[model samples]
Target: MAARNSAPEKRPGLISQIKTLLKFTKDVYPWLPWVLIGIIVAGIALGVGLGFLIPPVALWSIILWGVTGLMLGFLAAMITMSRLATKAMYAKIDGMPGATGYVITSGLGRGWHADETPVGVNPKTQDAVYRAIGRAGILIVGEGAEGRLSRLINEEKMRAKRVAPQVPVHVMYVGNGEGQVSIKALGKTVKALPKSISKATQAAVIKRMDSMTQGMASLPIPKGIDPTKVRAPRPR
Candidate 1:
């Protein structure tokens, strides 16, 4: 009980976390000097105009200016980081296998889980597999080489059956290779799972897997490899 309470206590304050993230991005690439410049200019201009119109609103006009400046700065920071994050994701996974799966799991919200499955072929067949077990059923996706991913996906289905035998399982091969689903179509693929599995079954499956997976230590990440860089690729 104490440990569970401590977990919640340890979560960072929301505003502080957002500020910390903004600072970290500024530390990383320093990619948006111009955006910051524009923000300062715009904030100053807006604050000056507003000050002239609403004389009594701000006790000290300078304080209002500073507040306005911070708001504009934050907005600018958001735009810069959003674009950089997208480009960084592409750069990180360009030559790696299972890249699409990374994008889906990271970009999508809850009810979806993903992991790398390097079943065969480092140069081609490595796959990023994803699963969503919901009111519908279990939807599995393998994104990588088309030819080998099918077999790998089938094996995963068999494994899931052993884990939760009653859950209906559906699979898709996410790739442009023959008889495969393309990367961009991943969300649509998942949205199509049959509404066969019940809410109770989904909850049971998650509980069972959570218990089974507990107490295992996470693998150490490779040197100089950012977590973002390993997005869709399975470890080789």
Candidate 2:
């Protein structure tokens, strides 16, 4: 008998991936197709203009430049589509509860340890606090009205302080209101924090904090939206 073959499944082809991305972005951004076309046209124009400035405009030179322009145009369009798709995804989930949790888990890049589950929640008000530990130490993000989120944020901060006394704990709320960070800016804000802890220290802090909250009851994520199903494509 032939030996059993074990191979990883192939990822979707590039054309298929682009189609999926285009469909998703178009749904959220109605003007995406036109915007992409404009970007591609501009890129091609720039490339061809550069070619014309370099030497005598021969037929071969024009063809070469035109092909180069077309390739560059597509490249620029793909990049713009990727960024717009990301923004559109965030906009789609902006006002939903647990959106912060979703961003924390999926939006933030590597070197950050965070869970999609909020560490503190107010069942009555549906307000919650999510936590993340990185080189910046601890980040506590609250979702809901600032007033209702205060208690939850405070409680989570205190828990972090108690578990890792030396580690710094930063708090911020997610919303369009005063003193709150918008969902689009959440990842940027977290990444901007000064790195105050080493990788070893970050690991220790996370382990200690996890142990402290291990026994606490896990709360159900707010209803009306499923964040896991809505993911932004990772940028190249």
Candidate 3:
């Protein structure tokens, strides 16, 4: 049986991350030149804004503008990159057996505990519920066709409530159909939930859930797709 460790993978250095991020920008937006131009213009504008606050001396002005422009440019790149990556990645994994779980788990950032594998999966419908513990209490991300997850959601909720009945168990559905959240906004949407627990409580929840699900089998990723490399640039 495969191990079920859920630690966040180590990220490469900032330089390497920037390269990967920029490469993604290029791949997803073929109009690379336009993006560069836009960022450059934005950068220059930011630099000009800062120049007003600083002295008019040539040396200081030059340095300040250079730094400001660079930072703004990188900021623009990261924002655009994340949006494009979200669209591309979600489009690729949408409607897959465990895509909702995959997207939710991968995109969650710090201050939360998330597992890439589903904590509860329905054999008949291929529905899966991915779990995360954070300031918002326990969240169950239900991924399947819209309106088809009542049974799975109820079962998973019961399982979660059985262990920690006091903790809130919120369910989020992922799909293009009505009443479902879009994949592109999955991470942001989850993070926006009201905080219901403290850091200590969140950790306790994770520890308890860990013990309960440690031996559970992993949910399957669809064939021929690599979730880790899904954000990588594709061949032209």
TM-score, per-candidate, Cα-based: 0.56, 0.88, 0.68
Q: Give the TM-score of candidate 1.
A: 0.56
In candidate 3, clashing pairs total 0
Taken over the whole model, the C-alpha lDDT of each candidate is 0.57, 0.85, 0.73
lDDT-best of 2 and 3: 2
The sequence of per-residue lDDT tens digits that candidate 1 reaches over residues 70-173 is: 68766766666656544544554543455554555565456654443222222333344555556666667665555556665777578678888888777777
State which candidate, 1 or 3, has the greater lDDT: 3
- Report the Cα lDDT for residue 209, model 2: 84
User: In each prediction, how many residue pairs overlap at the backbone (N, C-alpha, C within less than 3 A)?
Assistant: 1, 0, 0
Order of the predicted models by TM-score, top scorer first:
2, 3, 1
**Candidate 2: deviation at residue 195, Å?**
2.0
> How do the residues 1-236 of candidate 3 rate in per-residue lDDT, one tens digit apiece?
99999999976776777667566666656786577668877887778667766778476786779687878886776666666766767676666666665666667777678866777666777776777888888888877764677776787788788878888888888877677787777888998999988888788878888887777676664343456676654221
Clashing pairs in 1: 98-232
